[model samples]
Target chain A: MKLKQLFKLVLINIYHNKMRTFLTTLGVIVGTATIFLVVAIGKGGEAQVNEQYSKLNVGTIIIMPAQRGKVIDPLTKKDAELFQKSKNIAAAFPILNGSGDIKYNNYSDKSSYLGIMPQYQEASNLNLLGGRFLTEEDEKKKARNAVVGFELANVLTDGSPEDILEKTIDINRRKFEVVGVLKRMGDSGSRQSVDDSAFIPYSSAERYLLGTRANPVINAQATGLETVKGAIQDITNILNENHRLGGAEQFRIMDAGSRLASAQETARTMSLLLLSVAVVVLVVSGIGIMNVMFVTVKERTKEIGTLKAIGAKKKEILGQFLAESVVISLVGGILGVILGFANLPVLKYFQLPALPSLSGVLLGLFFSVTTGIFFGFYPAWQAAELNPIDALRYE
Target chain B: MGKESKCIIDARNIVKIYQNGAEELKVLDDVSVKVMKNDFIAILGPSGSGKSTLMNVLGCLDLPTSGQYFLDGIDILTAKEDQLAEIRNKKIGFVFQKFNLLPRLNAVQNVMLPLLYRGVEEEEAVRIAKEKLKMLGLGDRLNHRPNELSGGQQQRVAIARAIVGNPPLILADEPTGNLDSKSSMEAIKIFKELNQARNTIVLITHDTEVAEQMKRVVYIKDGRLFQN
Candidate 1:
């Protein structure tokens, strides 16, 4: 028979009973739609993380200090200078974190501050709203000048950005000049929220604020993103050589790339888990298709018999039923994929990272069609194997 | 009439037995018959008389338990399933009492089915189906479904379908059994007209009146054949 005629015959049968076909296809639709949504959202999440990489500086690495037995990790000025000397390393600085009560007239607030070199501004993507950032001269002379955060500015003057500039506030019982007020970076809270903190010269924190031996964290920047791992390697070797505490390397180095990689891996695992659940649903739906097809065969026994009497071979009957099953799933798959992408715009309105991918659509189509063929075969075979004489005799 | 009178179906000692648990029910016991081209023959039998069984054997729908049966010179009893299907497609057309039309297809589409099954192109199949339907006086009802047609019209449509592919033989089972007297006569008139075109036809029924209309008559009683 001509392929087109076969298709027409199959379509006629399907159209003759619309409700049964639609109900059978619904299971596949739900399963494939869920798959589409999950993959799109996963891709969107990865895109979002990549977008944040620009602000977070993917090449930057931080060496945190903690007591590893009798000795603590030392991020000294000399160590920073040695780190900067490396060919792959761009700039390195020491971070001295301390909290002190700062008093401005009648209002006094306890605030956290990071003592750093002048390189903190560019490395942190800090927006200086007013006044100059602390210069090298401030660190050299141990000047008591501070870079106030946006939140601290609100705490100090109860006014705009300009009100907090050039204002002096007492820190740890010593007077300090507010040299800069940073603009608020609201969404980058995960990147060590700089809004509520302050920055001061490292020399002032080491000499006056923390008179005791303060173990500071070392922050290093790679010249470019490609050199990050190399920069980390060179810095680790240099730090181990400098610390010289026997065989134990005293510092732990972490980078945005590693964190991002682990985050991506977790997302992938979650998406796969969700996709597996959807696959299970699809399998159930495939079974549902099988059941419906079996019932359809039973209902159409006389028709099959008539077709045979009119010269249809067993395989032709099988092909017709199988085509019906495939058409059901294919239609459901297309609709499910559309439904998956359809939810994306709504999700995006709520700030969800959701994107439709070509691979995801193709996979959905492949899976649905495979499910159709796999589940539809046995029932169609059963129909084909029926003795035409008996089928015709069936009431 | 030499070429037109060639044998269309020849069956000898065709025995078909059905197994019911340990009991063997002989549905067709040693039945034998020969039908020639342009022969308008009827097989008359009451319920359980094995006339349907005989029809099945002649139509190549079932293989005899043991016997030789040939349709249009092909040995159907020895033919494989697919070969039987091809032979049936090329040599035989069937009309059922129920009109057996696919309810979703209109009259023209249903009539075009056999030609379509024969791999005829769509336009050619439609043309042939239309010509046959017009001859059967269903030209105005080409797009009407089976349910939309009256009993006689539906039977006419079935006749049109059976002859549309130009198969040499038409095997009809109780063709007018569901119709009123007038529709039954109309359907019988169609059978006579088709037989006039030199197409061999075998009609199965329990009605002696319907049997009398055919040019020849055969009877099945208790799975055995008697001819006149």
Candidate 2:
């Protein structure tokens, strides 16, 4: 028989028994839809991770005092300068982090501050809202020049970037000139959030505001992503040599590469777990299809006999039942694709990320159809192997 | 030579045995029969007489335990299952007692089954089926499902289905068993007209009146055949 005619016959049979077909296909629909949704959610999580880490360079490494050790020798400007001389290291800077009160005329606000080198602006991806960043000349001359963050500028001057530019603010008890206001950068999976902090030259911070009370760390950049490990090794050699503590390491280095890798691994593991769930659902639904197909064969025993008596071969009868199951799953798969996409807006409304991929839809369809074929074969075979005399005589 | 050449069915010493663990029931015991082309014959038997088993063997639906049976010169015992199906498709037509019309299909589609199985194009099959149904006086009820049609109409549709493929032989099992007297008479008249048109037919029934109407009658009792 022509394939089209066979499908038409199968369709007519399915159409006449609408309730049974729908009930049999419901499990497939849910399974396919679950697969699609899982892929979309997985894609969304990957996108979110990429976006969160977008501002931080992968080669950037943070060096700090290890929490487990009491440091007799702290990271200093001289240590940073020595590390910058290495071939693998692109740039290195010493940073002193401290909290203090700032006074601008009568308005006062408190925030954490970072005393950093001139390269910190570029390395940290801090964009100046107005005016200019602290230059090498300011650092060399120990000029009390400060750069305030966006929110800090608003709190101090209650004005725009132009009004906050060049305003002198008192840090602790020393007067400092604000050279620039930084643009806003929201918090993410980074070592520090600089949104409301203040930046100043290290010389001025140590001399005027935080003398002898500073906690300093070194931040280093590698020339390329692949060179980060070499740069870390070089920095470790330089620091251990300078400290001269007989091989007892007192510092810890955290690289953005490991952080990014861990985050991506988390996302992949979550996707895999959900994918397993989808597979379980598909397998269960496949068993449901098998059960239903067996019942269908039993119910249509006389019909099979009648078809045989009218000269339908075993292959033709098998093809008919198999095509019926495949068509049912195909229909369910298409409906599932639509259902998955339709839930995208709902996911967005609930603040969940979803990115429906074409590959996801194709996989869903492939799995559902394969399930139909795999589960549908046994029952169709049973129908084909039925003896015509016995079937016709069956009540 | 001409008489042997015209034989459509030639069965000799056919035996069919059913086994139930240690017990064996011989359903057909040393039965033999022959049917010629264009010959109208009836195998008449009461219940448990095994006429249905004989019909099953004659129609190539069930193989005899031991026999040399030939239909249209094709060896029924030697043929494979698929070959028998193909032979049935090309050389035999069947009408069942219950009219056996698929309840979901309309009259025309039901009649189109045999032709469709012959790999005839759907349009040609439908055209032949419509001609057959129209000849059977179901011209206006082409779209009616079996449930919507009366018993006589359904049987007429079944008859149309049986002859649509223009097979050499028609094997009907109790074709009038579920019909009323008026419908049964009409069915017999249609069979007579079919035989007059040179179509061979073999009907199985218990009704003596129906068997008397045939050109030849064979009685089956206790799994044995007797011709009168």
Write down the lDDT of every candidate, Cα atoms only: 0.85, 0.88
Per-residue lDDT, model 1, residue A207, is: 88
Predictions in order: chain A TM-score: 0.73, 0.79
DockQ of 2: 0.70
Backbone clashes for every candidate come to: 0, 0
Segments in model 2 whose C-alpha atoms lie over 4 Å from true places: A45-56, A65-79, A85-88, A95-116, A124-133, A138-217, A223-227, A234-252, A346-353, B1-5
Tens-digit lDDT track of model 1 for B26-94: 999898899998899999999899988888888888888999988888888779998888777778888
| Model 1 misplaced stretches (Cα beyond 4 Å) | A49-60, A64-92, A96-115, A121-135, A141-189, A192-216, A221-253, A345-352
Q: Fraction of true inter-chain Cα contacts (below 8 Å) kept per model? A: 0.69, 0.67
Best by DockQ: 2
- In the order shown, the candidates' DockQ scores are 0.61, 0.70
lDDT of 2 by residue, B50-157 (tens): 999999999999999998899988899999999888888888889999998999999999999888888999999999999999999999999999999999999999
Instruction: Give per-residue CA lDDT, model 1, range A112-223, as digits (tens).
Output: 8788888877898888888888889999999999998887788777666468678888887888889888887665626456787778899998888886666687889999
Chain B TM-score, one value per candidate, order as shown: 0.97, 0.97
